[model samples]
Target: MGRRAVFDDPALRLANNLLDVGRADLHRRIVAALHDSPLEESYVGDVQDQLAAVVTDQRVAERDRREASRLIGIGDDLLAAIGRSGTVLMVWRRSPQQVDHPGQNMPLARYESDGIYQGSWGDIETFESSPELRTLAEALNWAQRRAPHVIVRPWWNDDTHYWAGDGPPPDGMDALPDHHR
Candidate 1:
């Protein structure tokens, strides 16, 4: 089995489906879909190149790579859910440069409600020093214990990024669900 960490996150259930289908079949379907896709031919060639570099098989490597792209694209709905519900506490708007290991990536979104996409915003933040973040947080709060702090920072967990929340902020920002340590 892969050594990937198993999270309690339900937002990624659809993406997890990719792992269920075997490698060969997934590649076959993905390549066919890409061929029929209305996007540019260069895009298809790029995808094919990526698969060729990573996948051992020549016939369907492009197919598998395309499948991975589909998995990630459809999975964005999960990210949007996290942002809408504020469960994605502090996160980078860009991918981290420190991908020392294979599968390392910026924090994915998670639902605080009924497992799947159904979730509530917990603590949201935009890229550092946003002009409208404060008002957004206030409007979202449902007359509870003052609004939480949406730690507005660049690169959520990057070396330059550092944010820590204590549940709901005394003034505003609250702890984000995806906040690491």
Candidate 2:
């Protein structure tokens, strides 16, 4: 065999932009970029211009740049996958019951035509459920279009060890929604 390829290749990583920063810096970068981008002019006639302006405005108190970056990251990952391969397989994390360290332990949800299907390693059964696109531009466009759905609900607190009351009952105990509290 010839020389084996190593894992940590420089070409593998996406260069830093507004996506790499913390919330405060991301908000600042977004505002600066908005001022310098075509969106400034095009936003005048755009339907969602007001909402975009709020996100891009430096004066906004709670800009929510973290959620913005997260949605953008999804598009970025899709693009990267398309760049490497013609198609990409996407997975969403679904947990009926809130669990600590969700990424490593939670079941994966694959979107299907009818509904979402969830399966875990230990379970022999798979749960089915309902839900996209092919091209990189289309993928990115789809992500951007769905960006508004990226609502950052407070799920858990590492400090207090508390999970959102809306989550499934832990240890099979009844858990009521916070709104009812």
| Candidate with the greatest TM-score versus the true structure | 1
lDDT of 1 at 105: 66
User: What range of 10 consecutive residues in model 1 has the weakest lDDT sum?
Assistant: 1-10
The model with the greatest lDDT is 1
How would you encode candidate 1's per-residue C-alpha lDDT over 52-92 as one tens digit per residue?
A: 43244454346554554444443333233223223223333
Score every model by TM-score. 0.20, 0.16
Q: How does candidate 1 score on lDDT?
A: 0.32
Q: Give lDDT tens digits, candidate 2, residues 1-181.
A: 0000110111111112223443344334333332212212232223123234435656434534333433343333332322221111222223355767757654443322222222111111111111222222333333323221111111221122212122353463333234522
lDDT for 96 (candidate 2):
55
Clashes of each: 13, 5
Residue 132 alpha-carbon offset, candidate 2, angstroms: 18
